[model samples]
Target: MRVNNFFICISGCLLLVGCAGTTKRPVAPVADASSVQRPVQQPSSTVTQPADKDKNIQIRAYEPSVPKAVAPVHSSAVTSLVAQAQLLESAGDLTAAVATIERALRIEPRNAHLWNQLAHLRFSQGRISPAADLAMKSMALAGGDIALKRDNWRLIARARRGAGDVAGARVADRKARMLH
Candidate 1:
């Protein structure tokens, strides 16, 4: 009887959560199922880009942007994996969290964010040297992301302090602080 009540409470909570939405747009009116279908307009080879606000006159109307040489990177899967890893870490299952992060890294091996996360977990597990090493790997992959670089430097500083190297820690700390 208690289990049945618990399930009912859980279901009600899930229904409430599922019904919540973030859309700001007005809802459209529902149409009849028997309504006639309208012809879909296919996009032409030419695509129009918004004109610059500063320039009053339009230079080009339909300029096709250069095709991307590579496929777009999808980070949704990584995000989910990261969330799972964080949950595991928060639950004190450091080994499981590290494994989850490793799975995400396999999908995006060059991702500095994943590397940084793994390094942080390593640090928490008292593996200071490997944490610092992973931080350096993240630093190498931190292209155009100054904040990630700074964070890696901070990790390096922490690792150095853990190893009782005051001078190295100070130098790394200075490097991290220098990054604006």
Candidate 2:
């Protein structure tokens, strides 16, 4: 009796699922391929003419305007932090100075000047590789500031020299000179 009930339930569910997608509305018959009409393409009737000088309508290729480089501005908070960091450095507290600069960097990570200052601090602390790398980061963010990029190159040259890379130092020095 249980097996018969289960079969009836299964059959009823199958029937319901089969009827779920069906509608009582009649379906239209599909048109045959031969009965379908294609749209006719029209030919261009307009003629091209040169612009008249008297009409002041000269055809010219579009030229995009070049963007001007603007200087990066530091906020009041960043300036204060930089001053504090400078004082700490002057006081011979290198660790505190670095921490202060890092705090400022957290506030303005894209400031090229801050990155340069951090690189300068790192260089002073005898971290040659990191100093060079940080200087490069500063240069990347320096944008159109030729002076800042030159300073970064000078710092990188010093770092290379400190790391016993004389050739690299000279190359960096050359780059710095070229930016002059």
Candidate 3:
């Protein structure tokens, strides 16, 4: 029992050390204020200086120098929507997933992932023609990504099968196979 207690204490110490080393320090906030000191202005002397003469010497009122423009924060909506769509698809609610993906598309129309997801949902729902169309669009936007091309070929094959064009389906399947 004493030996077991000693081993447990050692294990606990090791665990604590592991956790301490893995912990991250909080990030410091970015300072937006300029560090440059503003020049002090003195009372003007009786001498009537010409308007244009001293204009160049006058320090502009301390407008806090405009901060550099930052890119917009990444929205959680896209990630959350994609997660919800995946869950709906996994639960066999392909229609719901498609609808969710459509909403995401409105937010990020150029996103290849969203387009591919919608195409997949359409294919699963047996909307073959639309699936093929979406897949083609995704492939075009993805710029020759092999995975997108393969998915496009898959949709084309499915569309051909749905249209009762066995030869077309076979040719599409062959194209997809060639991609490997």
Candidate 4:
């Protein structure tokens, strides 16, 4: 009976995992040999012909990409800068790391991620008030970003604890727990 219960529990966990996916999934286009249109290339003197010269070839057309200007301060760019800041902080250069993050914020003023990073940095530097303030700013700008809100609330909890505000820390901790 114990073994059967264990198996049932494992099966139930697997079932839940399988069901925890995105609401929608994209369907891929099924390629058909006869329906594919191969671009014809001009035969040049340097071109070599294979033994199966009559074999069909397929070349997908180049797809136009979105312009960089469409997204101000590209996500990768901000991520790279944040990574640099973390490296600087790890090297005990808190000032430089904060400067790097501040610059990133100037570029992406509305980015809650940058604010959250700044809050974390301040927390590490023992600036509890500023850390809490920056964390709150991040939370305000997070919009519908649940992950950012969770991080910000956790940071706020820590900041309050560091400043000896147990009551505030408990409240922030509760909010963070709700997100988790």
Candidate 5:
């Protein structure tokens, strides 16, 4: 009889622990689906156009648009300017050539070729001091081109000759000859 009572008590304790481990179901509030807003649909064929492409628009005519003030001068422009200046100088229009070179210089002031060309122009026009100054500037900026160095020496010689410095002219001439 005692064994039967013990078994009964053990069974009752196991059942109670098992029931305590379970969680109860929660009650949720109901929601109305009809109160939600649906997203609007966009057309599939919508196309975007640039604002500047309108035909029949009258743009107020002003002075023809100049290039951007700070745009870098391209190498092609520098080459063309050099060729044009050479042609003008050959045709005895030293003044125009000088002006053209000056314009190019404004675009690429650090260009050695432009500086050398300006020196040549000044030397041709009998502006000795300015020519020497330009030649020095060119030499300082020149890369490792032998022809450019030779031309620089020639400009220096011309400037020295114009200034009546025979020794200086001789020295420059010798340097130019060495480059050849």
Candidate 6:
């Protein structure tokens, strides 16, 4: 009986949470079935009719603006974790440092600096592909931080060079130089 009650309580709480999480959008007022107008069926004729112009229908593309460059703010916990990771890396414990950074990332997944740090760590470990990928991710989230993006581009160039793509490395290096 106790187990059944516990399950029932859990189910109810989950249902409530699900409902609370849903957003109520502004719904279009539905016309009554009887009040809705139906199109008249016209007999087939040879006469061509002009296409209907929907004056009320206008389509516009949505363009998202680039975010302005602003320094990222870190919480004390994250700052502490970064410090610890730095210490671990300095002590030749790259694996443990990476793990510590990963923990910080879990706390602030969108932090560009954290992603950049992870990319640098991966680069130091000679994981070329992941290092370049993580650096790209960091650049994507870097907003307008020219320095950070430049650093990421440099990292990507190095990764590309390591992978024997001289042309790709040159392109990345050019991009980094352009930021200056």
Q: List the residue pairs that clash in candidate 4.
A: none
Model 5 misplaced stretches (Cα beyond 4 Å) = 1-74, 178-180
- What do the candidate models score in CA lDDT, each in turn? 0.86, 0.88, 0.77, 0.82, 0.81, 0.90
lDDT of 1 by residue, 1-180 (tens): 999999999999998887786458888999997796987544344444556765454333444443332222439988889999999999999999999999999999998888999999999999999999999999898786777888899999999999999999999999998876
Clashing pairs in model 3, backbone N/Cα/C closer than 3 A:
none
Residues 63-104 of candidate 6 have per-residue lDDT tens digits of 444445567688999999999999999999999999999999
- Considering summed lDDT, which 10 consecutive residues are worst modelled in model 4? 64-73
- Candidate 2 lDDT, tens digit per residue, 1-180? 999999999999999999997879888999999999997544334344556755544344434443354455788898899999999999999889999999999999999999999999999999889999999999999988888898899999999999999999999999999874
Q: List the residue pairs that clash in candidate 2.
A: none
Model 5, span 4-69: residue lDDT tens = 999999999999999998988888977789877898544434445455766443333234332232
* Candidate 3: tens digits of C-alpha lDDT, residues 1-180: 999999999999999999989878899987666965677655343344356854644333433332342222225998899889989999988888899989989998877667877887887898888887887787777654666677678778888898898998999899888764
What TM-score would each prediction reach against the true structure? 0.59, 0.61, 0.54, 0.57, 0.54, 0.61
User: On lDDT, who's better, 2 or 6?
Assistant: 6
Best by TM-score: 6
**Global CA lDDT of candidate 4, please?**
0.82
The all-Cα superposition gives candidate 1 an RMSD in Å to the true structure of 22.2
Off by over 4 Å in 1: 1-74
Judged by lDDT, which candidate is best?
Answer: 6
